[model samples]
Target: MQASHTLAELEAVLGEQVKKLRLSRNVDQTLLAERAGISRRALQNLEAGTGSSVASLLSVVRALGREDWLSLLAPATTINPLTMVRARRERQRATSVRAKSPTAK
Candidate 1:
């Protein structure tokens, strides 16, 4: 999705949506926070979209039974057939990083 607005706007929108979801589920902030294994303040911060840790967000999502939302952020991996074939052909037991630039050689 295009971000035409600021991150704060997005956070607010998310917070509102979460609030609606919680209401629909007939859950209170205290109960939700307890289920999420976080402090009430943290839950409040999340719902406000002010700023919170990824772990806190995840906990809240889980508590709300919205694990599907996580998939929206990070979908399952899929490999391109051509790239997979190339990788198989050039497979190595191990790889290491070079300390210096190739030009130094």
Candidate 2:
């Protein structure tokens, strides 16, 4: 089963990621916020680990030219292995029934 976390916690994690990326890139938050067209206060909220919209983060990310990381940060998808195994078995059975006679080899 999958577990869930609060928006606040998720935001905190994202904020930390942003702070690390920004510092690693040697850019200050003010310049980043200005380029993103957001108030410095909003940027501060992000850095301070307050819950904010993904759009807000994306705006800052684009402003910082770090938009490439979005794909990397997508939520992980869970798989039901039992259901998949059943489906695979069903498909194999169907395939066996639908199989054509072997052509002259």
Candidate 3:
């Protein structure tokens, strides 16, 4: 999450993780791709986490027997934009109130 981190680094780290997990489970990339219902190229890109689709990611996770992984990453939508805006406004108001108050610290 650091601003200085490059996209290539992120992709490389993700690719490495996927590779590690796969090798640990003794799963080959070709077999993993087949189980994920994706092409080998798509699997490669996904493990790299670069220019990959949500659907493809989900498929790969499921192939890894982690069906709930995607849901955990992006749970079923609940909060609406209006609610988010209201929350932001409340935080801003609290911050302004604090700024106006005398503090012991």
Top-TM-score candidate index: 1
lDDT of 3 at 104: 54
The C-alpha stretches of model 3 lying farther than 4 A from their native spots are: 1-3, 71-105
Q: Which residue pairs overlap in candidate 3's backbone? A: none
Q: Write one digit per residue (lDDT tens) for candidate 1, span 1-105.
A: 357968888888888888889999999999999999999999888889898788988898999999999899889989889888777765556688759977896
Put the candidates in lDDT order, highest first: 1, 2, 3
Considering summed lDDT, which 10 consecutive residues are worst modelled in model 2?
A: 89-98
Kindly provide the TM-score of model 2 when superposed on the true structure, using C-alpha atoms: 0.60
**TM-score for all predictions?**
0.76, 0.60, 0.56
**Cα-based lDDT at residue 103, candidate 2:** 93
Runs of candidate 1 exceeding 4 Å displacement: 88-105
Global lDDT of each candidate: 0.88, 0.79, 0.77
- Which is superior by TM-score, 1 or 3? 1
